[model samples]
Target: MVMSRRKTKVNALLSVLISLGILIFINVLNQSFFKRFDLTSDQRHSLRDASVEIVEELEDPVFVRVYLEGEFPADFKRLRNAVKQILDELRAYAGENIQYEFINPSASNDPVKKKEMYTKLSESGLTYTNLTIRTKDGVEEKILFPGALITYRNKEIPLQLLKSTNRVPSPEMMQNSINNLEYNLLSAIHQVTQTRKKKIAWIGGHGEITGLDAYDMVEHLAERYTIFDVNINEKLNALIGYDLIIIAGPKEAISEKDKFIIDQFIMKGGAAMFLVDGLQADMDSLQSQNNMMALASNHNLWDMLFNYGVRLKRDVLMDAACAMIPINVGKFGDQANLKMFPWYFHPTLITTKNHPISANVNPVFTQFLSSLDTVGNDKDIKKTILLETSPLTLRRMAPARINLNTVSIDPGFEKNSIGKTPVAVLLEGKFKSLYANRLTPNIEQDTLIAFQEKALLDTRIMVVGDGEITKNYSNRQTGTVYPLGYDKFLRKIVYGNKDFLANAVDYLLNDERLIKIRAKEIEVRKLNDRKILAKESEIQLANLALPIIIVGVFVFIILIIKRRKFS
Candidate 1:
């Protein structure tokens, strides 16, 4: 018996040493090659390969200051947990290069100091959320900043935490924001560390939109890209240096020479975004009277577009799902009583989910929007519809008469739906130039023009039929520009036009890895409310008594086994 006990003790010691040795060996292997295993069914803990690669190549430290540390509700707590988890994962890959801190803007009790911190954060581009919670002294209000400030070297950028289409901070919105936390972090990191900013040129001199209308987009984009206003003036190589070009709401017709220059630019693998308006309709026309005429105006680029693939129709569209406009419903004591009415002309557009460009975004807003159709069966070019109308849609032909009273007296609104057409599309592939066969011998032979029949590399071009999608409202007197998609009548920003435009540009510039990351969806499981309510008593009894019963049985069995072995 003494020999057997000694042998058992020796075996236990050897087993412990062997386990330690295996652990040390594994640690040495891990130091050389870092790897993480995610056992989650939904891969919630796994980061994308592109994100991992980006984090691994970091040469400098990126410091993140998250301002979500104050006392908040459970949903916000969940968001904070998600942020912490993602940052930890990134740190695992980035090592000492990734540093972070959780800062509570309201940590200070002094009012003046807390207010100063709030101002500083807001000026640095973080949005604040106002919450009302029931305290011991009635209901109290708390302001929380659900955002982060990422600093790389001398550059600091702001990233919102719950960045999604839903304006309301609901539970569903929180989940959506959590699903996108990884993409948001990695994208901000990549932007702050870029050695050179991309170049974007805006085509001018065609009565295009000014900086006032596109202030939100222009100002926001200037941080990541070098924007320039260029007038081609029929020049051959005017747009050769730009990575992307924007043509928003051109009023005048584009000359043939300028069009040819743009064609050759695309043939050389340049990306372009065209926000054009096919109909001449505006709010000013209706202010003079209750009725107005919608006419199709030609910008003289139809032939070139038809050759490319899409035919921008010569009509306007409407939908039962549309935005509201204020109208004079009645008067009281010589005062005009303005009430909100659904303006069919201003359709709230539904985006497609198959493509990452428009996936997981709220409905886009458009005014006096037109439609388009894919014409040819070009196998070389792949056409994807990015935005379309809902099933309850209707159309108005050019010269169709419309009146404000139609909102109330329309016979067929949602019941007799007629239209569901593509309003925005993305065309990707080698594009055959519109001027391929029309160029003269001298023009073709000129080296400056260097016209290629087909595109040198696969490229992308996006066309949206409504220019208002890119235009932001501005106060004429104060010179203040509201955000893009801000509805003047509703006095709020209730649409996702800004997100759609930014995503479109990201896809066009060959940065689709981040977009795919943004498209990841985390499954949200919920309990059955009816079943829980029905089985409440039984569930309570099980939760309160089952653990004690199991522990008693386990203890009794262990005691009995010990007694038998000793006996």
Candidate 2:
């Protein structure tokens, strides 16, 4: 009996030890396994990982504070959710190095505390909107503002306006805004993480579109790159220093000398983007109220592109879908709903392909667009279509006139025969220069830059047919800027066109890091209403009794085994 009792005790002790060991192992495995699984959707996963990289490289911790007051508007819930999700992701990925906080000024109804918070937010350059709501008696009103402030090493960067809720939300707008957040936040982080800024050059002169006209686009890029506006006319030596050059909408013909300089710059393996207008349109008369239209075959730069297997046609493209504008034909007396036809110039919708540039871009609008014809097939060059017209598009040869007053839609506009046309194309690979054998032009050497070589043979180039499509012309009186094609403000900005431009620049600079960031995917989860309704009672019962039942079953099994052994 003594031996049997001793044996039973030993067995019980061993079983308990084994169970404890199993429990410890399971707990450790669960913690480590959950860490590897990013519960965020694909889009958020990319963003979170990118944020992690930034935070991990931080020599010091950064603090981010979000301030949203009262109950958020229904429409703004998505923005709030996105911000929260990003913040949580950052906090998780940042480990203990980065700290974040959310502040609701309304947490305390005390006026003093609220005022102090408002003052601090204001000092930090955070923007807020006042939400006015009437009281029970309809006399009193209240206001609220929600914003975010990021602080690093005592420096505070406040994001006053998270998003705009006045207009309907668009995917492009949301993506663009999120991208802005990524760019701005990452750039700030990079200041501490990186040792130097990347160099990017904008090629000027040769009647190229002025950088002043591209202020907004350049400003956004300046956040990440060291932007330099180079007039290649003074010297070719300066071109060698820039990692990339942008030929933005050159109107005048490019001289052979300038072409040589550009070619040499490319030959050095420098990337470039050409936003050239196929049929150059002069607004000189239109702005002066003369309503005169002129088409000039001034983009001779195509000579170089032609040698590379890409040709920019001079014909203007028209689309059935276009923008509408109200014009007064008779001075303030008679007004007509004459469609400005801005939208139809062919709105290039974003393609869901794997190309980094067009990914997540909204539809882009183009006006007076020309077709890009591939010339002299070169097996070495790889061409991709970045923008194309709708199937209901037709080619209208230039020297076309735009009369806003008597502008009548062609009754036969839909009948015109033209298949889907390509407006923008991306070319990569080896290229031969048109000025390979030609001597440099002696057109006033005063501003001429010398060439180092024929051209960068292996380089990437993006060519867009219509420059006016991206141009925003505003009336000085109303201060209302007219979008290139569509009247929808959100549509104009979100469309793939702007994203394409930005992405093209990013790609040319070989910044694959940002390209990867653009490929994020959002995971949406919807509630299963039917299952919830059908199994409501069953689910409730399971919730209440399942754990108890499981515990009882285990206890009973243990008791039965013990009793049998004892008996």
Candidate 3:
């Protein structure tokens, strides 16, 4: 027995020593090599190869300042944890070059200090969310900054962490925001690290909004592109070097010469966004006088668009699913009563889901929008309707009068408006020139004005039936314009105009692959609330008794085996 015990001791010591040595060796190897196994069905934990490459090729460090740290609800906590996990994954590839820090801006109790910090963050382009939490005694309000500021080289960019489309927050919205975490982080990094920016021109010879009025639009595009105003001025080579051009809300007519220049540009593989105003309605006149006439604007681009694929009709669209405008209904001193009425003329647009450009976007708000009808039968041209009105939509053709006071009295409005009307479309493939047999620029002196009847390369164009969707409202008091798609009076962002416009520009600029990445959908699984409530008692009993029962059985089995062996 003593000899057997000695052998057992010796064997135990050898096993311990061997295990220690193996652990030391693994530690040494771990310093130089790394590997991670992701067992997720959708590879949610795995970064895309493109993202890994972007990080691995970094010559300098990318610093991310995450502002999601604070005492918040369980949902926000999950979001914060996910952000950390993603950052760690990124750091595994880029090592210490991917640096980050978590900051809780609301940690400070001093009011002045908190305001100062918030002001600075806002100026730096970070946005915050306000939340109200229920406590045992009462409800308390909280402010959460669910965003980040990323800096690489000398460029800095702000990333919004929440994907909110409505005024109220929902669990689905939070999940969608979480699903986009990787893309948002990597895209921001990619934007700052790009050595050369793509050039975009906002064509301006036809009275498009410019300067401060168009600052919001320009600022967003200038983040990833070099944006400048280009007045074609009938110059043959005016749009030669531009990757994309935007003709946003032009009021004046485009001359045939200028149109020919644009057509030739498209022939040579160019892309453009045409924000056309098919029906002109004076909103201010209606607001002041409570009455106005809706008429068609003669910008003279209808024929060109028809030839391409879409017909921007000369009618105003109405929908039951629309926005509300406040009106003073009571007499002058009767407490100044303000009532809200559904404004049918301002239809809220529905975004198409199957297309990447409009996927997962919220309803777009429009003023005096026209319906679209696809006209071309060319097999070479592929047309996709990106935006449309709800099934309850009707068209009021030109020569109809619009009276704001008649909204409450229109009994047949809902019955008449009952069909999905197309408002925006995307045209792709080789385009046949509208000026195929028509005369081109007087090339008597300018040899550069060459005409190709058909597109030499596949091109894309996005046409929206309403121009006001791209225009932002200016503050009369401060002269500062709200961001495009924001409703100042409603004090809410009820539209996805900015998102749609950006996606449209991206699609036109030939970033379909990248846009597809943005359109990736992750299914969020959650326990059904009603089922959980119904089975709450059963679940609690199982949780309390099942583990104890298993443990008791296990102990009884072990005791019996030991007793049998001893016997």
Winner by TM-score: 1
Q: What's the candidate order when arranged by decreasing TM-score? A: 1, 3, 2
Mind giving the per-residue lDDT tens digits that candidate 3 earns over 302-332? 9889999899888888888788888888866
Q: What TM-score do all the candidates reach, one by one?
A: 0.83, 0.73, 0.77
> How large is the C-alpha RMSD of every model relative to the true structure?
4.2, 6.8, 5.5
Query: How does model 1 score by TM-score?
Result: 0.83
Can you rank all candidates by lDDT, best first? 1, 3, 2
In terms of lDDT, model 1 sits at 0.86
Per-residue lDDT tens digits of candidate 1, residues 1-567?
999999999999999999999999999998999878999887899998788888888999999999999799898999999999999999998999999999999999999999999999999999988878888889988898999999999999999988643444877678878988998899889889998888889888887876788888887677567889889898877897899999988888899989988888888999999888778787778768888987776567788778888898888888888998888888967999988888888899877788988987778999889898888998989999999998888887788777888878774856667768899989999999998778789988888667799998999999889866888889879998888877777666678898788888889998787777776667778999999999999999999999999999999999999999999
For model 3, what is the alpha-carbon lDDT of residue 139?
A: 98
| Candidate 2 lDDT by residue in tens digits, 134-203 | 5667754444555676676756555543444334445545544554555545545554344567778877
Q: What are the lDDT figures for the candidates, one per model?
A: 0.86, 0.65, 0.83
Model 1 ranges with Cα > 4 A deviation:
1-9, 25-43, 67-79, 103-147, 153-155, 160-179, 235-237, 332-339, 411-419, 488-492, 522-567
Alpha-carbon runs more than 4 Å astray in model 3? 1-80, 91-179, 211-213, 411-418, 440-445, 521-567
